[model samples]
Structures are given as C-alpha cells and as structure tokens.
Target: MANSNLPNRIIKETQRLLSEPAPGISASPSEVNMRYFNVMILGPTQSPYEGGVFKLELFLSEEYPMIAPKVRFLTKIYHPNIDKLGRICLDILKDKWSPALTIRTVLLSIQALLSAPNPDDPLSENIAKHWKSNEAEALETAKEWTRLYASGA
Candidate 1:
C-alpha cells in the first residue's frame, strides 16, 4: 500500500518472467516512464478473442497496491470485457482488487474472461445489449472485428 508497490509488483513479475517464462503475457515498462507500461497478451484460443493480439497500457499511480492500477487497451478490440474507450471491466480491477493480484494473475483472468465473457456485466452497454439480444451475431461481430482490427484478416 505504499508508493509504487503495485508497479513494483509488476516490475518484479516482469523480471521473474524475463528470468523464467510465462505463457500468453509479455510485460515491459517504457524507458521514459516507469509508471507506464506496454503489455501484450495472446488471445485465448478457441474463444472469440482467439488469434487476436491484445495490446494494453498499464498505469500505476503513486498510490499503489492500495488502489488498483489503471489498465486500458491500446488496440482496437471488440469484446464484452472492453469498452469503446478501451477501459476493461473486471471486478479485480475494481472492487475486488488486492495487493495479492499480480500482473500474471490479471492477464490470466483476462484470458479466462475471454473464454467466459460476462456480457451481463459489461463495460459497453451497446455491446452488452447486442450480447443480450443476439448472442450469436454479437460473437460473430466481435470475432470479425477482432480479425479486422486486432489480426490481419
């Protein structure tokens, strides 16, 4: 809960992964800003997000580990998890966050979310509406948009 603890956790996890290896996540800090980072997560295969590369920006504030870090999509992705503004809707990012939630855990949770998206609890109302009204069409649209924007169609 002290200053930059969240970033420190991220940095440590990144260092650990760099030293070892973690699947589906590649996290690195920007040379200019240690508080800002660039992260890449391989889309969960067999899910609507499969074959997509999710680019994300993570911002850790001075008040960290107490307040969860801010994470947003840098890529144009269409999913129930992400809103149009790229803000991800996850409980861990919100009310449920604890200092114990590591970057790896967050990324893994995202992958799991792709497999079981909670359209009932969405960041984007429009996307949620589509998801509620026409699930198949929404999934196809999400998949198509992912191919068009996140992947080379």
Candidate 2:
C-alpha cells in the first residue's frame, strides 16, 4: 500500500511545480498515475545540448521522502554522465539523496549536470574517454545528438 501522506505531498509538489515552474524544466504528474510524472528539460544554453528539449520520466515510490525518486531520460543524449540506458551518473540520485530535496531541486541538479559533466565519474566510460581524449570532438558529437534527437521534442 502507498503511504497515506504520499498523495498529499505529491499533490502539493505538483501544484507548486505548475504554479511556479522552474526555468528550462517542466514536469507534470500523470493523470492515470499521480506517482508518475512526465518531464521535459530544455537543454541549457551555452552547452552542447542547447536548443534541444530532452524528455524524462520520474516515478516516486511509496518510500519516497525516505528514498530518492527514480528518474531516467527518455531522450537520447550523447553525454559522458548519461548512459545508453539513460541512467544519469549523479550522486544526489544515488547515495547523496536527502529528504529535504524536492523534485524541483532534483530537476535543477540534473540541469546543472548537463552544464557540467564529470568525466572522472561517468556512466559511459567510452564517452568519458572521448571527452578526455578530445573535448572539442566530444562536444561536437553531443551537439549533433542534441540536434538530431532532441530538436523535435
């Protein structure tokens, strides 16, 4: 069974997200399942992903507030920190999650991750190696992927 307070928390968070949306990011709870959310993140400007709109899904579990929400990219992106499976290499999404962090903050952190990828700790070692070997080329490929896959969304 889902937590009794979960619905209230989800409702309040959804309302806040709709009322005061974050720049370059938007999320809405699914009508069928309030625990599921459809998210869109506008690629940050000045980055390789600029001018792209990346889709993502976020699912809050019954243990949410005690555990972090599950998030994964639906859009294909050529980023060192993002894997082929669309799992992001972010600490907050893993062991660093805190109950105080809201969906908005998580989205913002994801946006920040897009702006600054840490090749030292990457989801795709090949991409990380490419990034390390030739930064310009890696960035170009990322841009191409953004233009190819993420432009239409």
Candidate 3:
C-alpha cells in the first residue's frame, strides 16, 4: 500500500524549497509524478564548478524520510566524488542518511561537495588521481567541462 504520509511530506518540502530557495539551487516536483523532481544546482562561487548550472534527478520512494531519496546527475561533471553516470559518493546519500534530513539539506551538501572534493574516497578514480597528481590541471579541466556542459547559467 502507498504510504499516505509520503505525498503530504513531499508536497510540504517542495513548497519550502520554492519559497525560501537556496542561493544557487532550485528544484520542483514533476506534475505528472510528484515523486520525481528536476533539480538544478549552480556551481558554488570560488570553486572550479562556478558558472555552471548542473542538472540532476531526484526520486522519492514510499520509504522516504525513513530512507534516503535517490539522486543522480543529469549533467556531466568532472569531479572525483561523482561518477561518469552522475552517481555521487556522499555519505548522507548512503550510510549516514537520516529521516530528519530534507531535500534542501541534501542539495546543500551536494553544493558543498562541489566546493570541496575528497579525492581519497572517490567515485571516479581517474579524476581522483588527476586531482591528487595535478590539481591545477584538474581544476582547469573541471572548469572546461562546466563551460562545455553546464554553462547555461
């Protein structure tokens, strides 16, 4: 059976995200499917990803709030913690998730991840190696990728 509380919770959260929006992020639930959302995150200032607007998809399951939402990038990003398929290796999205966390908090965490990548625990080994071995070049490549793929904003 569908969780009766899930839809109402999702609607409240979506409304909050719209009203008091974060500085560089915006998301809206799909009209056809309230469980799916189209998300856009602007690259944090002073980060290599700055000037880019990345797209992502977030889906809430019936177990949401109790279980973490599923999220993935739709835009290509050159980051050590995000795989080519756009899967992110963030703790909150995995082992650290809590029912108290909201979509706003998760998106904020993602923005923080773009600002500070952890190459030691990486999703993209090649990008991690590049980040550790030649950070300057890696940053440049990241900027180039942002310009090519996510420069809409």
Candidate 4:
C-alpha cells in the first residue's frame, strides 16, 4: 500500500517540474526509468556558472521524502563542492535532509552553491585549495567550464 506509492509521488513531482519550473531549471524523465530523471538548470547570471545550462540526474527511491533521493550531475562542471563523479557535497542531501524538502529545494540549493562556493566542506580538495588561495582563478576555471561544456561550446 504505502510501499507501492513511490511511483505515484515520483510522477507527481516530475509533472510538477514540467508544469511549473523554477526560473531557470527544467527536468524530464530518463529513458531508462521513470524513477530516474534528467534535469538541466540555466546558471544564474551573477554566478560563475552563468550563461550555461548544467545537467543533473536524479533517482528517487520508494522511501523518498522520508529519505533523500540520490542526485548527481550528468554534465562536467568545475566547482569546489562537486567532484569528478558529479557527486555534490551538500549537507542537506546527506545528513541534514528534511522530509519536507523536495526536488525543487535541492535544485535551488545547487544553484545557490554556484553563487557561493563553500570551501570549508568540499568535494574536490584541489578546487577547495584553489578557491581558498586564488578565488579569482578558481572562479575563472569554473566559468570556463560553464562556457565550454555547459554552453555548448
């Protein structure tokens, strides 16, 4: 009963994103599974990730809402909180998740990460070191990646 309601909730949220997306993000179902999703977000203009569309993939489990869904970037990006595997280092996605949080919330958080890079807890040590020592250069690389991979250049 309750255990089988995963697909219904997943469909509802997926439909919600399609119906009324946030200011700069879009999402759709993945080819392999309805439980899996494909998403893209236009970088906010003031952030280093600007002028580009970043891709991410999401996987929602039956226990979602009770447990945080799994999310990973499908596109290559450079930032202190994102690793080579596209895993994001956000507390809410890990230990700090609240049952009330939704896919929309997670996407917004990633967008926020772009405007503010938190080197204190990083997914890439090298990026963190550079972000701390030479912020300008680090932002340049991130911006460059957005220009290259995300902007279709």
Every candidate's lDDT = 0.78, 0.92, 0.93, 0.85
Residue 4 local lDDT, model 1: 58
Q: Which ten residues in a row have the lowest lDDT in candidate 3?
A: 1-10
How many pairs of residues collide in each model?
0, 0, 0, 0
lDDT of 1 by residue, 1-153 (tens): 223544456567657756755687777767777767688877788877789888888877777667787888878877776888889999998999998776667767766787788888988888888888999998899898878878833
Q: What TM-score does each of the candidates earn?
A: 0.87, 0.95, 0.94, 0.91
Provide the global lDDT of candidate 1 against the true structure: 0.78
Q: Local error of candidate 1 at 81, Å? A: 2.7
Better of 2 and 3 by lDDT: 3
* Candidate 4: C-alpha lDDT: 0.85
Off by over 4 Å in 4: 1-5
Estimate, for each residue in 1-153, the C-alpha lDDT of model 4 and write its tens digit: 132445566767877988989888887777567777788888888999889888898888778888998989888989889999999999999999998898888888888887788999999999999999999999999998988889945
Q: Report the C-alpha lDDT of model 2 over 17-76, residue by residue, as the tens digit.
A: 999999999999887778888999999999999999999999999898779989999999
Listed per candidate, the RMSD to the true structure in angstroms reads 3.5, 2.3, 2.5, 2.8
The order of the candidates by lDDT, greatest first, is 3, 2, 4, 1
Cα lDDT of model 3 by residue, 24-85, tens digit:
99998887777888999999999999999999999998899999999999999999999999
Ranking by TM-score: 2, 3, 4, 1
Any runs in candidate 3 off by more than 4 Å, and if so which?
Answer: 1-6
- Residue range with the least summed lDDT across 10 consecutive positions in model 2: 1-10
lDDT of 3 at 145: 99
